[model samples]
Target: MPLHKVVYLANNTKLYLWKITEDLEELYNEVKLKDSSISRLDGMKSESHKKGFLAVRKLLQHIDYNDFDLYYDVHGKPNLKPQACGIKEMHISISHSHGFSAIALSDKNIGIDIEILKEKILKIAPKFMNLSHLDNLTEEEKIKKATVIWGIKESIFKIKNETGISFPNHIFEEDFNFEDKKAFAKLKFNNKLEDFKVQFDSFEDYMFVCAFQN
Candidate 1:
């Protein structure tokens, strides 16, 4: 399908989402991929992954960008080329879940993630988050909240994009209400404490989260 949704997370920052309704061939036929992307897509083991890869390229097109203008760092973080005529380079983060792909663009550094809600997060919560935060929440609420926390950590990691940052040990989220649609977190790594502002939303059994350095 075309662009699914656009969310303004902050001034000069936008999150673009694409709901994957098209088949693999349809998506592949729509987006033009560079040889590197084609090789990466060929190496993918699942059709779902290939569609998600192409869907992101489709999103780039929605914003007047194409796969040729995007590249990844040694750490696997996505980036956009410097704009023509001296326009500021845009920071980008890419994510895809079961049936959705998303890209966040901003003048400042940013990270984003999307995850499908499931009961399994609760079982693994203690490994990555403070379980006490899950108290007093219903089963459904726990799943939603836990998924948000997980996304928060993942987004933070993407922003930092460095070695030795542990989700449970280095990244931490302040307690947040599901209704607030925003939160705060800190990364305590390398004898430094860095703060982040987090924004998130839910749609169709999926939780989307983005983090900005504060």
Candidate 2:
């Protein structure tokens, strides 16, 4: 399918998920791209990567914006250019896994991430989060929750867009149950403190998280 799902995350925030069912040619022919986007697409070495890039543009068009309106900063963060007349700025974040690509947009600054459930995250749990947070859960639940926590930290990093923000030392997620599907986190870096409201859900064996700056 094309646009697999649309999630209304908050009053001004929304998420879009695209399941990669179309082939390279099909997706490429579906959307209009700027010259820069076309060059970027041509330089991609893999069809999967090309599909993800094109699929993101599809999602942008779904919301009445196109690739021309999107740009990346020196920090490699994706941003949107204002339309003819606008006073508000829209924050956007993008993520892609093996079989899916997603984008989230909101009037408020936000970040998002999606990850395929895998055991490798279990191996690196200590590198990015508190191991104690995974206590009292089956091995399966542990993997799921750990993946969620990883996504939370990644989303938080995307929102902050600052250099030298170590995931293990700078971002901290509060304890919460997998059943709750939502949590909060704190980012302490450069002698400044900030908070975020995190929400996540599982789909097709992948977990996606959205973080709203607080």
Candidate 3:
């Protein structure tokens, strides 16, 4: 049938997400043929990995995947050839959950994340949330508030492309509300401040958030 959801953030940035439709076994077979790394399966784990990788490959073709040698760094982030397509730099992030996988690409640094809202987000809210943000929400509203906070943090994590930073506290989100369908965040790294705008949208059963610096 049709491919996954592809959202363009700008001329240089795009997001890809797959919504599964076909049988898992069939998809796994297709993925194995495309990438030999996926053919070693005899159990559930292999099947799951095959499906995810296939989804990733499907998304990759939607963008400029040619002339770019893809490799991963120590932290497992994908790197591209600098001079590919006359672009000096390329930044990308990948996320997948449930039956969906997503990739974000941009000329400058970018981070995109998707979350399926669930109740478990509430249990870990205190770890990443700040006092100011927590105080603004009532007890009954914690779960929804926590999910948005988690998404914002993930977006910032992708934007910063670094590790060892706290969310809401280190990466501060400024004035804009998801309820109003918009938000803005600022990340301070290496003594420089970078700003990003976050747009919240729903696709199927997922909550998608995209952040980028232009």
Candidate 4:
């Protein structure tokens, strides 16, 4: 599998997904990485993680961008070179899980996260989300809903990229139906309150969430 999907979103946002079918060597040969990226790749301990990193570069190349056009802030957030993105205010957020890697590009503030649905999220649901939201749902529904809430919080945190933001204490998801495929969350951090619009979808056993500041 190559490019899995491209989601065009509101506010000039586009989310790209890549299914990682290539092995580490195949991926490594497919993309050109900068010196720093090369060093980082060399330091990775997992083959799957290395494949994910290279797959992201492959996604960039699919969009006519490359590793040279990508950089990271001191905070370790990925950024596109202004000249390469061809937009003054372009923003990007990236994530990977298991066999998938994803990136979201927007002219507005953005964050994205991809999660492999698992029963583990259910056991830890109380630690991050409101248990009331989990009521009235079957066991399967509980797992799906819990995964979405976790993704929502993760995405919001990625967008904010600030310190001391606790998922349980700082983020709250509004009530929503599983069929709605969208939700809202509030982040109360640093003595400031902020809202985010969340959109998500399930692909295979994986779920991805994208957040935009509202």
Steric collisions counted per model: 0, 0, 0, 0
lDDT tens digits by residue: candidate 4, 97-148: 9899999999988999999989999889989989999999999889999999
lDDT for residue 123 in candidate 2, whole number 0-100: 96
Please write out the lDDT profile of model 2 over residues 125-204, one tens digit for every residue.
98889999998899989999999999999999999899999999999999998899899999999988999999999998
- The ten-residue window of minimal lDDT in model 4 covers 80-89
lDDT, candidate 3, at 6 = 74
Q: What lDDT tens digits, residue by residue, belong to model 1 across residues 89-129?
A: 67999999979999999988999999999999999998999
Clashing pairs in 2: none
lDDT of candidates 1 onward, in order: 0.93, 0.91, 0.65, 0.91
| Per-model TM-score on C-alpha atoms | 0.97, 0.95, 0.75, 0.97
Model 3 residue 36 CA deviation in Å: 9.2
- Residue-wise lDDT of candidate 3 within 60-176, one digit each (tens)? 654546313455576656666666546358777777676777788778676777787777777776677654665676664555555666777788786666766667557777644
All candidates in order of lDDT, best leading: 1, 4, 2, 3
RMSD to native for every prediction? 1.1, 1.5, 3.9, 1.0
Candidate 1 local Cα displacement, residue 105, angstroms = 0.4
